[model samples]
Target: MKIIGFKINNYKSIGSTENFLSVEPKVTALIGKNESGKSNILEAVGKLSFDRPLSSSYLNNKNRGASGEVSIIVHLEYYQSELNEFEISQANTSISFTDNRVVKIEGGLSELLNDDELLMEAIQCVLEMNIRSVWGNDSNRIKSVQDYLNGLKAITSQVYINHSARLGNLKNWITNDYTSKEDLIEKLEIIDNCLTKYYSLLPSVYYREQYPQLEASYKYDDIKNIFKEPNHIFNRFLLAAGITEQEIVEAFEDPIDGNRKTVRNRIARKIQKNIEAEFNEFYNQEKIEFQVEFESRVFKIYILTDDKAMNLSERSNGLRWYISIFVDVLSREYKNKSLVYLLDEPGVYLHVNAQKQLLELFLRLAERDNQVIYTTHSPYMIDSRDITNVRAIEKVEGGNTKVFKSAYNQNLSNDSKMETLSPLVQAIGADLKFNIGPSTSNNNLITEGITDYMYMNAMINYLAIDSALNIIPSAGVSNINRIVSILIGWGCEFKILLDYDKAGYNEYDVLVNKLDETLEDKILFVSCNEEVVKEKMWSNPQTIESLISKDDFKKLSTPYDGSSSSKKLAAKEFHDKVVNKEIQLENETVSNFQTLFEAIEIQKHNIAIVRD
Candidate 1:
């Protein structure tokens, strides 16, 4: 079973219904400022995988005042086949069979077959009478009954099939006549044994938690001992790296006393090659090599860079932290077993780029069908392109924590919550600044906000244009002029694509008057106005949201409920649908977007020609 999501209640800093948090299946990131309860969400989620009671320290102070029960409910998704297996396993344990000998008796005689002494005596008397009657008149009938009884005895001799078949026969006999009490109890015991084995083979949920303290130490002896254990995470790493315990022991064993350490050197080189191969997939850094040596009956790890070797512990804090945690995770006792991994602020000490590499590792692990839930405030850890994965946590009134799907609800008006949302805000701002701010790329498109960037990029990719343009989003239309001024000062060639509404027009006019005439051509508006768009596309106001087809527009509008913030949320949903391909673009809508791309491409071509 995979955990789809979960709900938390009465946990620390989470008091009431408003304090609950929802988790995503693959990689759920809990992001908020310090003391905003991001870690609390991770802690609560960890509690669900195991039957552990909440520590008294974690009980919500606010809820304790009201005597509320602290609980967490996890929603799981599994195959019907698993349920069938469990049921079949349960049924196998309760199944019973009877002795085949009892089933062969004739009906009139079966009624008198309760006690062992009486039944045997009656059967012998019937056999003697039948034999005498059939001795010369019906010898064939006598032989047939004898053959049937012999076959039943032969079947009962086979141990594997005998017990169940015997139980079945016993059950059938019990339906007609009472059986011996000892025989009935013996048959029940047989069923119990079958069930015990069946239940043992059934699958169960496995949970593992990796705390930061586990990765804090990297001493060679400690690392070596960890690899010797079967279930240690480091052992898995070594196995994945193509090293065996026997080989490790051999490397430590010196065949020659002082012969340049040939065995240890060869193993270390092999390990280095494997380590580099594994780490390079996620980490972008200078080529790293490892050296393993046995000194004073202990193994030491050294890293080689620039032809110089340094102790592994001497590496940067970020690299050391990453390596330690990576080893710990990879070495998990149940790494191969299906499990839900709960990581709390993992890689917190890593550099921004290393944290990003750590995110890549999380994705790789998740691809193996395991779910990962982690908490982080670092923007690098958040996939900005897919903000739907983010769940923002904040402290509300009465010291309660609340979680929000930030991408689903863009215009969260509560200013008090904004402080807690600073990490996400900074993440988006960083993304914008990195993509469109002073850089080598000359072609850039600046839009009003995330929705515009989303729609425009989706259109650009859908059209498959070859333009080398980077799309950036200003906080809003009011902020567009400041971004334009900054780009102009940087001597960066950029195009301003704005909404065709009054606010957008006002911003465009103000920006034009502030900049010189030379940069005027870089500014443009979306193709259609409110009146023309309403007549052609069946939507009003001519905003980017209106560009979507009527059907999608209706779907987006369902969640708005006439609230201003809800309208912004609806726009976010619209953008997500368009980008995720959930909403099919109408031919007319595609044509309109194609026209926009054509305009931007033509502008880019003209600017390139001018520069040439």
Candidate 2:
């Protein structure tokens, strides 16, 4: 089985996240500031255990007056399947066995939502009726993942007709009377037996923050630390690779050439090859030749790079971290079953490019039957190209943590948006080129064309209004969708500013039709993240040109050019006058533009562009 997602709620800084934080099949990154609850999230997922209960500290939320039960759960797929792609194909089985038609959840309290009910019922039905499975302890079996994925697919389908109405408050049902959060705890134990076969097969999660450095020369006595927990990660790594005290002792007693068929040399060669391969592939820092020695119980490890040879301790922390994680992660694979690696600020010590290299290493580690979930503040660590795996975490001062699956969360308060979505500026900004040079700020405003852009700029400049939006002029109203798509791709924080009139409303409806809720909601709100912009300013149908008074527009217009050309010339003239302080804009014109600007400010205009 594979972990497709994890959810954390009612923990230290986190509240009930609306949905499961989906993980890309390979690797995932939890990104935010230092105290934004990113590290807490990693720790929570790592703490999932069958035998242990949460500490008393976990239940304490006196700070935020949090009274809800903690409900953190992970969704495991028997086999990874895309939405609507999994088919319920049962395996043909003839073995006579128990007729029990349950998948463990029969032991827990019910009244589950329709989706959960169908999911469990479907799994149980398949487990009872049609499974050619490998039965383990307590009759827990390894049935085909097809049945499991089909159950999830039922709820995750693209076709809207397949969805059920929000029947009831899921929170109420889940916590109706779950005494001391037993129901939530039961979920972990229940899945341990029936639903999560592959999850159960793995050993306990190995979480780490303090990575031990590689030792150049180990004393004979240091071998005793091999089986130790977290503190001796480098030793644990070596142990996982089947290197032993016995082999080291023999090497000391009987030294031989590396090409010989000796146990020590073979071990040395393997370690040398793996260290070099792992380092070279992931770390973009100076390339080095490994000095892997098994000549004695005092085994030596060294690296020669940049024409200088140095022991592991003499290297930079970043280099040590890179090599250490390489050995540490690979060692986990030697345990026979896959394990989740909860890494904390993995590349914090690395520079920009080196941090990016660490991300690549993590991707390699996750693809090998293991899952890697890391937390970081650096944008270099996040892959915006395919961001399904990225979860932006935020915590307002003295507020519960809010985890957003998408950067475009309308629910985010303005401060939260600036805090959580800021990393995306450099991450996505560098990836795409724009027709216009963007203002240093990211609160972009997409306009229909140059005339609207010029007029808005002029108005803002003249009024001396501290407008936060850096207006971006698109080719026309019809071309807005293409720019919107690009902004969405970059995960940019922006708004669409169009003429609030009939033609604009029709195009808005067209946008509403073209993109689904997930895509459209990020960029297609009516006005400034649903803040009903400019409603009282004018009741008549109007264009951006209407923002200026009729007499002022007539004063600026020319008889030489056509209508469109005339508007462009008029807009330029007004902009020059505003910039040079040559003309004082009328009170009505100033009020009209300020009304629109205030609406944009209040909501940050994710969508408001339309034309008449």
Candidate 3:
């Protein structure tokens, strides 16, 4: 299943936001600067699904009257079969089902939308039924809401990793309510007694105390000794109900061995041991491992550290930042559940290479159908290729927060692809090329043909003039308007250089006001200096008696005297003469137009002239 869409509101820095998650990408990166709502997106997922704390402190939103709430809605899609049963083979003619019977259930995977009731059922079903066999049999597959929930359980909680603070709360809860080891052995004995109560003949079999004392495995004596009236078990109940530890101790006498003040230390150890055992079982199914080393004692997967290995508490902020998170992630993965990971500025102290490696690991997790959302200020963690995914998060003027994509949104131009890795200027250059803008700092020198563009560049280099002004040649007069609109939009400096006759003036008239309005300060109108222009090259003179004479203009209008290749050669010859000082070119800027050809002489290449 894949999440298709998401919507959220009033969550931390996010006033409201909506998005569509990309599909099965090798990688999807969220790009945004610090506090740009990227973390808010992650938090919304955590808040809705994982039962995370929604306090002012957690979200830095103390001013919302401490009553703010976050909401998230997600859309998902997946493949489903047409049968309602766990497996319904199409080949079974007798058990035929229509298409309406098949559906692909989608789990609302966002943590923001804590909809897990159906998911629980799905889990129960998967546990009880032979899912793999059913799936393999081309069996009747039903798209039950429970199936979606089950799918979510597999995906969302696989590695629901969070930083230390969140882990701290989860550990406290799990230790207090579920994995408390003392409770495990006590509960086991309770089960035994309950069994004995049901079957009179099995009373001997249910007698735990009658068994021999054993040190290496679970102990029947330890179980009986734990719940001996008014012991830690009772105190644990009182503690859970909000009684203070001191009050619980005062009210209860030690039922075990009849000691009063010696509280149950073994219970804590027992709980820890039970958790390890549960972890082992979970890992056996999930193919993961969880281990840890504590400073106080050797426990499950113990790692004993020497005094030399331990650092002073005052100087261990770096270690503190990572150690707990590392443990939490491994533990969760070991439990064999898919999880949406939340990381708040992870690697605040790690080396750059380590951060990069961490990001690589995050990618691997994502590839395996887990979601990892994190916030960080380190540039090293930014996947340059995923920069397009960055959303600029900001607080608006009306005290509302907003998230917006950067001007560098991927759709802007192909050049935007380079923005992630290339230098700013080089990326800008590519952008301009793709956008086809004319003149950045000064008025653009627009020309009538590619020949003119080549000549202009050659001229600039020949004159050895350093200028930021850019020149782009319109493929033809028809494209001048388009080039003008873009140049105007960019508000760049520019100049128009059309041929000196009717077509030139017409294009200038149509574009001059456009440039004036959009790029007023930067635009300049520079016509070809009539006197210095090549009289022999004029294509269509407006008057009967013009520079090269009416007879020459009439001849120019006639069909070309040779093949398209020969015409191209003639055009090249004219350009070379203009650059060589053999043919006197026009004005000061026209002087520049001639040099582009001189810079890199257009090599001998075939040119196709339009047949008249």
Which candidate number would show the highest TM-score if scored against the true structure? Answer: 1
What residue runs in model 2 are displaced by over 4 Å at the alpha carbon?
Answer: 16-20, 50-64, 80-204, 227-231, 239-242, 253-263, 294-297, 430-612
Candidate 2 per-residue lDDT over residues 1-612, each given as its tens digit: 356566665667777645256665567777766687877777776765422344455444322546566555555543323112333332211111111121121101111212354345543443342222212222222232333434333422211111112111111233333343443334323332332332233234678867776666776566656534444765655654566656655565554555233866667676666566666766656778776664445767778898788877888887777777777776776655567788997877777777777777777777666788888766677764334355777776556676765454445566666556555534544234421224345577777665676677776666655555666555458767776776766767777775665556555656667754453443432233343234432354456777677656656645213365466557657776676576766766776776777666644353223211
| lDDT by residue (tens digit), candidate 1, 363-455 | 777666666777776667766545556677776656677777553344444664456555555454423444323344547778887667766
Candidate 3 overall Cα lDDT vs. reference?
Answer: 0.37
Q: Give the per-residue Cα lDDT of candidate 1 at 558.
A: 56
Evaluate all candidate structures by whole-model CA lDDT and list the values in order.
0.55, 0.56, 0.37
TM-score-based ranking: 1, 2, 3
- Report the error of model 3 at residue 408, Å: 2.6
Error of 3 at 73 (Å): 0.4
Name the weakest run of 10 consecutive residues (lDDT summed) in model 3. 202-211
Tell me the deviation in Å of residue 266 in model 2: 2.5
Clashing pairs in 2: 498-609, 498-610, 499-610, 504-610, 504-611, 528-605
lDDT of 2 at 88: 31
Off by more than 4 A, model 3: 16-35, 50-70, 79-320, 385-389, 405-407, 410-612
Using TM-score as the yardstick, the better of models 1 and 2 is 1
Q: Model 1 TM-score?
A: 0.63
On residues 23-134, what C-alpha lDDT tens digit does candidate 3 reach at each position? 2212334444344455556555544322222343434442252244544344433212212222322221110011111212122222311333343443344334343332
